[model samples]
Target: MENQVAAASGKLGVLVPGMGAVATTFIAGVEATKKGLAKPIGALTQMSNIRLGKRTENRYPKIKDFVPLASLEQIVFGGWDVYNENVYQAATNAKVLQQTQLDAIKAELEAITPMPAVFDREYVKNLDGQHIKAKDTKWNWALALMEDIKNFKEKNNCERLVMVWCASTEKYIETTDIHETIEAFEAAMQADDDRIAPSMIYAYAAIKMGVPFANGAPNLSCDIPALVDLAKELGVAIAGKDFKTGQTLMKTIVAPGLAARALGVNGWFSSNILGNRDGLVLDDPDNFKTKEVSKLSVLEEIFQPEDNPDLYGELYHKVRINYYPPHGDNKESWDNIDIFGWMGYPMQIKINFLCRDSILAAPIVLDLALFMDLAQRANMSGIQEWLSFYFKSPQTAEGLKPEHDIFKQLIKLQNTLRHMMGEDLITHLGLDYYQDLVESL
Candidate 1:
């Protein structure tokens, strides 16, 4: 099993669908890191270390060293955006990073321009741009996107390609009969069905081209049975529904602790204000519903209210996202958590998280891309539940619950890597040492 994965040999093309704040920040950050101007912080593949054996063996190594992951030097970035701005211009417009950092990698960022994108105004009502693909049926649009993928890979001399959807959330939609099978999906595309979103078309194109796809937004992009089955049939790796950043990231961390300590959560009121293109898209009630569902699912799964009814049965969870232009890419979130402990006495936990949206998401994009590629090389396909560590709504198979606890997610992720490398999976059950001590005594 250790020798099963192919080598990460040549240039890997990272094709993004929406080249806005999150996309631009990711590309620029990678460029800056490659130029030695910055480090790949918050990226587990680049920064975090994995423990291979027991606590005493001291076989700890960076995940990058432990796995055959593509390096920053091997990455070539390109993507499609509704906006025509190059990454440099987009990064400047984003206001996420300092202008000085953008200036440091100006030429590299400017050299990469967005290809025309597949856009549907009906899906994302709050945004419109002129750089959209020519008017065509959804099937034709997917064909055009496949052409884009081919041209990008050939032109960039990429040995492998992976698409990370860094796009805005579309209006809420559910899986209909058309989304039941690839044949139905293709027919719906030919018929130009309104239910087929731009992200789904992009996902179809990428997976059809044998490219691994990762969804970074809370859209039903590759989560439906159609794309999920297609990926497995084609032997391509796919994951996600939304990146677990900022507020949700904190919830996964804190909520797990509360559950572990058996503290009762009565209410959790969450609010956020952001002003990026994402915020703009999410301002629409229809589009916001998609995000709201993604954000709201975190607690129920983590808390398991039905299992512990007395602790969480009466829990109230509310989520709100306000688009404030002055905030730019800075997202400020507040969470008021009401809990109770001994004697059922109530207490409160107020959390205010002022975080850079793209800054947090950029690293997630990198990690997913690298991990998706790694999963491909390792011959893994379909929804990568292990990569759920990076997502808010982890796309699992139907009838399965997603793990929202960040700590458990990390352990699952690390253990997956260990399993990949033929190393012993660390269960953290130290009873073996105690057993040995008792035998010695």
Candidate 2:
């Protein structure tokens, strides 16, 4: 009883909406890996393995071997960016990787130039670029993007394509009346409503074209009911709202361990300093609110404060990000956690993480692009909560809370893969072998 998944053959084009540091870094890394210069370190689809049977059966296989995924050599890269620099120049400007490393694949990077991007200053107020689409109605811009998609697919000869939003966070936007249905959304686009952000326009174009779209920003880009419904109607797959990296990544990993141990958390104060374009975009209070909401939601869902009032109800969590040019793409984060145990005895946990922001996120871009393509081939569409392991605020079905624990997210991810291949699901409740102890006792 295997799921009917389409064959992963032919060239697969990975399209991105923004070709900034993160996007350029991801492109450069993939090119470097193809040339045998470096390994894709953080991507699970490339590096992780899956178990297919019971504990007694040694059937662990690399995920790429188990699942039909595109090979590194079979990938073709194309994207749009407000800054029209080629990937090589963009990667050099990013300063996330060394000049020597980039020079090794200079020709390959330089050959990939970004197409004009759809941007509005209102959504991201901190920066401006000359390489943007001409001012026009939102509906017109989306049509132009659809044309771009068609041209890219034909030029690359891609049998399949997926859109991963490696872009800046637009200002926080709530789902409004316009976002309730595809018809209302199209009307808003035609009317040039201010609420229709550029990211949504890209998403609409991709999903309407039956392409899978994965959002790596905190903006409610493709998470709205309208887009979710559109994805289902078009038989396209979509997943979104922020790549989980740095501080929030650590929080999801640690908070779950705390909850498992029943540790009573009082306060968790987290702060970050980064000098990338992301840090600057987030410096704007409006944009920061979007990122902050995504980061803060992890602890609450992981802790389940409402379910265990005494352990987590009084929790105080604050998150901050400051723009510091000196840090460049190397972001630093500090977390101060206060917990109580043994009749209210206080204990403190402190963590200082000096991490490269793009370095951690580049692999996420890779994994999502590959996984979203897999989802579409497997006939899965709409909100992809199983792919929630890579996001901070993953989109779920309406009225459903997102799962934020990294361990549980990993399990769900693995189980999804097993299910797709018709392998037995692993439940980790292997005490049946000990049944003889009950009779002996």
Candidate 3:
């Protein structure tokens, strides 16, 4: 028997919590892709293919053709942002896309002005904006957001809605008693508890409305127990923690290979220079701590220090984000690795990756929104870990360590799609090949 999954029909509304550099880029890119003015260079939903059946089946198909995903042309974009500017204005300010590109879709981008956002100066200390909901209570603010969601869906004529948190990295906060239960969390919101964050408010509002939510930042947006339990209760699909772009994206890809080969590492130092809104938010020590934790967890999990203490237990991993205005969204990262091979001979690897931050991240936003919405349609709910391939610190069920190895995450993602489509899950066991060969002969 198969799970009762819904088909992807009708328009999908993609709501973003923070309509800044990354959100604007993604919005414009989607619009451009729809207009046939540009190709979706990095989006997997538009560009990736999936393997099915067996290695010999020759059954690979583009993921979009394999699954029932909403067409890009049918996607309508709306979002909330602290800045009152429309997406066009924000995109122009971002300077990521050129004027010629923005000019092609000017009207559409301008029409999608940002709704006033739920903002708190305390959670994001580095930046402040005038366009914000000033409700005294978090509960009231959440109520207001819920109203916004309802209006957006109706106005957009959307058959479904999904929210992606494209906001700044919130100041680090541990999960406390208030986050243990939805009841407690609602009480904390009603009480205006300082521990509750704006992202959490957005999450509460989205999941409560039965909308699928994907977190694109490193804050504990939907990762808290309150939201997770509520998602399960509400039967909504959710994924989160951070969009794995730039350096961490590279780390997840390369670190797993080293561990696979049983390589020894003494130290791995990573640092980045970026000037996007995200970089500025992360420049704050408190905000950076949250990003630091997310970026630092990958190697430890990939290397499994508990399993190979000698190789990684003393692994001195340090990550830094420097705010440099000149770089803008063009983030340049540097990594220095100290490794030992065969009888403890020391070798060093230095990598300097000059990457466009939002360029890489915008596609991640698209893939997550599409896949999370697909999960909801597939009757999947709560902590979609198979979607972990797109995140830096993936949210897992309680007592579960997130998989950070990029290749493994891809296999899980592909297998989930296969399972959803009633195809056999690939296990890479090929004893059947011999039997099939004899039969064919």
Which candidate leads in TM-score? 1
- Give one digit per residue, the lDDT tens place, for model 1 in 279-383: 999999999999999999999999999999999999999999999999999999999999999999999999999999999999999999999999999999998
**TM-scores vs. true structure, each candidate:** 0.99, 0.98, 0.98
Which lDDT value does model 2 have at 171?
93
Q: List the residue pairs that clash in candidate 2.
A: none
TM-score of candidate 2 against the unseen true structure: 0.98
Q: What ranking of all candidate models by lDDT puts the best one first?
A: 1, 2, 3
lDDT, candidate 2, 38-112, per-residue tens: 999999989998988876788989999999988888889999999989999999999999999999999999999
Global CA lDDT of candidate 1, please?
0.95
- Indicate whether candidate 2 or candidate 3 has the larger lDDT: 2
After superposition, candidate 3 runs with Cα above 4 Å error: 1-3, 435-441
Q: Which residue pairs show backbone clashes in model 1?
A: none
- The better candidate by TM-score, 1 or 3, is 1
